[model samples]
Target: MEVETINVQEAILLESTTLSSRQKNEMNVMKTKYGKTMENSDYLEKLEFFVIDVIKTKQMDTLLTLNRTDGNVPRWFVTGFIRMPGFLYAICQLPRRYRYTNCINLFIDSCEILGMICDDVAGSRLSKVDFNTQSDEHWTLFVQFIGVIYREGNSAGFKTKLIRTLRLINYREGEYTSFVQALFKAHSRIVVLRIDFEYQKGIARTVSLSEALDDLDHLVANMRNNAMFDHMLGYIFKVEYGVDRGIHIHSVLFFNGARRNGANHIGHAKQIGDYWQNKITLGRGTYWNVNAKIEQYRQKGICGIGPIHWQEYDLQVNLLNMVIHYVCKEQQMIRSDAEPYRKIIRKQHFPKINEVRRGRPRTIMIASVSDQLEVESI
Candidate 1:
């Protein structure tokens, strides 16, 4: 698939509103109070400040913080990044006091106030969002915040094209991030495959991301002696056309036996790396070298107490949450860089991945069920 190109965030200014001199003075005092209250805070506190920002105007963005606090981003920066149309992606690691449902509802309420109108966040066919989940162990809600609109229909004057463009980039990116994070963490161990330097083509070479993955799929199943080992191989990846590195892939591959079959050590790492090099690279000439790194995260004891001021904001680490974010970090990949190659990359690079590839499901568990020829799970 071609890389998506979105216009970066536009510069925003708060809409002018009529306020009495006394009210303006009160806001000014609160501005100073906010600075002193939240100075020298860490990631946890930044999260709290985000909720406070939500509570301040009962929303965020519209460059509201511009008039209030001097943003010393390098030192006291917010915990997350901002996207197009001034949408704030704050890292919402819920503390002990607040539950995931409560935090997310607040975030949903605040973020829905964004776009041009209150209902602008409403889907074409849907209105509300249901983020309630049974699994709290792997939850990390990245709160999306927007500016508050005092007047209900204040957005009627918004141009049609501008409004459509904002909605597309705003929610689409959020949904993509959420889907990727959920899918990756659902698996037990995620193998991060970094396709470095080897398969990069200079001119007529159409080595796409899918091509490399297809090669890995064949080698992986073949690693299990090509019996019924197709179930052991699985992968999900994103291609990055770096400014200097050209085209490369950042992918997360899964194996059913990786955890119980001693796949954590470097011995297995080298074996997987060697398969990519010898088996997958044999026909690609001397230029084909595969660079692989296996990232295994331990979900235990990953939480820390809340920041000094925001002590209630403690957040537990989700399984593979870090790796999911790392692989899905398309924010750093320049669309302009990838745009030059998107046209040339073709479906031919993918071939018939499904017929030849094997994938692992979230519910699979390998256990002894009588005498079986190979591993089995229910």
Candidate 2:
């Protein structure tokens, strides 16, 4: 039962040549139950080094060198194009807009060799994915869905940590797009707003993360309860950092005022700014900017205006969806006890909602060579 090797490991421990106690136990069990194809001691060490080296480096030659007789380990390996390293490179190495369909073709062309490269090399296995999830436009989506489940040997804490780290690294565009699409799909009329932080009379205040958070909290409460948006339908907020201007909050408000095509009082940027500024103050002399915008969904494009609105070219870009994507995008910030820290202020929206419409869920605990069918001849 040689499943096609994907080349990515279940966890970082796979990045090492030595097996954890859990992996050692799994191999021992597999040997007793399924019988060993090769000895575990020296050969398994070689296989471990091979997997770590190949996946991290994404070397084809390294992959070609793998052999069951040499590593003396079970044949489970990285599933599908997960081995090429190049396809996975876009996660961090390649341009955000970069797409290489030829890379998938390359994997298809070499699948047989890749299929022959590993023989019974397992410490982990991939879980089956529902084929319906595959998109005809993005074939790799299905292949990438399968993941190496590091058998019952890895501790729960260890697996949890690995999954957490991967969420920040793996395929995420689908998650972002899906959530954004779902929000605006229900409410097409949107407002994109930004609140900037200004020092009091040009004096920088002590802006700690908690203080900034407090400012955002107060702002959201006033916006929803204020006489201005009292007739509003729904709203959301996001916090982002400025390289020199400091921390600010971004929001998209979906109101019932689309009936006037944005001619109403809430549609005016100046009024929204004035009222928004009065609610949240950063102490002595400090203030927030009322950068607000109104957009309409017409002609399959978003029509809007603001100080920064001229640069927006795509009318199809939903301001609400854009705001949702901006806020929901992956962020990595560790704790800091100092003022002016790079922390995102908005907590996950109350009543967490993840309405994914593409790809797989963030977690997959268990995958096959037979699962590696080309949807179309490459």
Candidate 3:
């Protein structure tokens, strides 16, 4: 299988529109108040529509459409690092209330709108879940939306003139600070790498535990050297759920490179697997789907979340942040020095461990052996 380079530039930004019903309503309210309010009403209206409503609606639509589950991620619902001080900054600066019902309503409405458009475009009824389950594709779309929002929020247009009156919540207290923090601490860097693997004709195609471990070790070692060479503190480790079976890794490294100054080397990183895979191999008579690589881990069964278990995902996300932080600090990077990427380095959290288990085993034994390295940079 040949891995194609992911063009970050190929990211598609949804058309920016100023025609939201919510925005129009707010405009009328402002006009009724005789424009006497001290609030930066126009700016507030845009932020609410663009960032809060649009992003949330897109995410909710994907989740509901794919999972067929129907609980809203309320503005007040802190999804991990999003709860930190940074989120507070966002809320206060935008003055967007984290109302539960209103947020859900907006999400459902967005889904309906998308559904209507999709139905018309395809000339068929839009089924919530297709027979093959395109959940992964939907997830990719959601991630793209995230990328777009990040791009816009970080743009000079939104930051300079229009939002001058806005005092964004400090990165420490932003709405999604926990998630941001979990991902971007001064010391920890999220490294995503992609690798292509070719199987020896029909042999079971999968990576073994030792291979996964070796790849992780190599990445960490290089990360350490990079940090040391630059005379910066470095911490490095591969994050994984060590289940004594086949393994997957989420490696985080702290490097003291010039990245702290303002270089954006972040994304689905490609360097890790590039060194391992030489010439790309094309599959004969068959092609590989990108999503299969992400879901190849053999697992028996995992139970659903109980009431208490519901928070486990959040806990896991938080733990990941701590682990990355600890590793980076161990390597000598100071958290205080990460001011440049503060907003980009979100403090997000996952659910707790016990909450994730919810009493079901998530293990499936696979005796089959294949020769493919199913890895991607996250």
Candidate 4:
């Protein structure tokens, strides 16, 4: 069935006289599949030239044009002409920071168009090789890479290469290799913690989430300067449990003196239970439950400190998920060679992942249209 076109393509036609050879081929290919015609060759020619001009400008207009095509444009054509060109252009034209930022924008746009962008796509993008970085842009890349990967027909080997590159980028800083080192070096740590006392709980009906977060933030900041904390853990997080969740925290303690048999001791991680019980109550405010449940707890002493193992606890992982289990959060780094505590480093190569399908009828028409136009004029 014929679908209405978006006006952006019409704007392309109005601003130019004819389609480029490349656009003509694309148009023909699109037309043939639908058993339709780029019936208005004059308009098609103009639109083709317009697309070329936009692509040449490196303005990321391919996205605008592609989106404007409505349902008339098939996936194949969009992938090849629009997405590929825009992706490559952004990669080439933008600075490393801007390129990453724009890539994220494009991925987000695609997600909004496609519905429910998955984490796998973010993972795949993050795994892409860093063009010129000493260390992988792990966080930035992961945000976009996974979305690209989840899009149908992406190559696994390509993703693997990208991920491998990211690993190298992550290792650029030699001094701050482990969490222990990071704790010692404040500059290398990215996150801060906070703790605050509810000056007036039990008097107020409820405490705002913002207030709780502020309290946590205050606690995190105050704990950073603790002599024992600073001595053992440089950048380690100091958590304060509020009366909300039973007043305990899932915390990591840096035990610099902890001993390691084969390798150097990393540090001891622990959870202080019933954190609320230790808090100095404010005048009057109602605090929500923020305490996590504790089950089996064990500690194996390594150096001087212990790596305490608890059954499970919930911690915030990202901006989206408010509550995430400690197990899943920790396990995410299981395959990651970048973790501070990892000892066994194994490299496994997986097979290449993409498989292309035969061209559909619509594909031929678009290709034909794209070919007939003068690519330079467009």
- For model 4, the stretches where C-alpha displacement exceeds 4 angstroms are 1-109, 115-169, 172-213, 224-231, 237-251, 256-378
RMSD of each: 19.2, 20.6, 24.7, 24.4
- Evaluate candidate 1 by giving its C-alpha RMSD to the native, one decimal: 19.2
Better of 3 and 4 by lDDT: 3
Q: Under the 3 Å rule for N, CA and C atoms, how many clashes does model 1 have?
A: 0
lDDT of each: 0.32, 0.35, 0.28, 0.28
Encode model 4's per-residue lDDT on 30-147: one tens digit a residue.
Answer: 4233333232323322333333333233323333333343434322232233223223222221112111211233343343343333233222222122221111342233223333
The prediction achieving the highest lDDT against the true structure is 2
Please write out the lDDT profile of model 2 over residues 158-188, one tens digit for every residue: 4464455344423233343343344333333
Model 4 residue 366 CA deviation in Å: 57
Per-residue C-alpha lDDT of model 3 across residues 225-341, encoded as one tens digit per residue: 442223223222332211111123333322223233213222222332332232222221121222123323213122111111212444334333333333222111111122322
| TM-score order of candidates, top first | 2, 1, 4, 3
Worst 10 residues of 1 by lDDT: 304-313
Q: Which stretches of candidate 3 lie over 4 Å from their true place?
A: 1-206, 222-232, 239-246, 257-261, 276-378
lDDT: worst 10-residue window of model 3: 300-309
After the best TM-score superposition of candidate 4, give how far the Cα of residue 283 lies from its true spot, in angstroms.
13
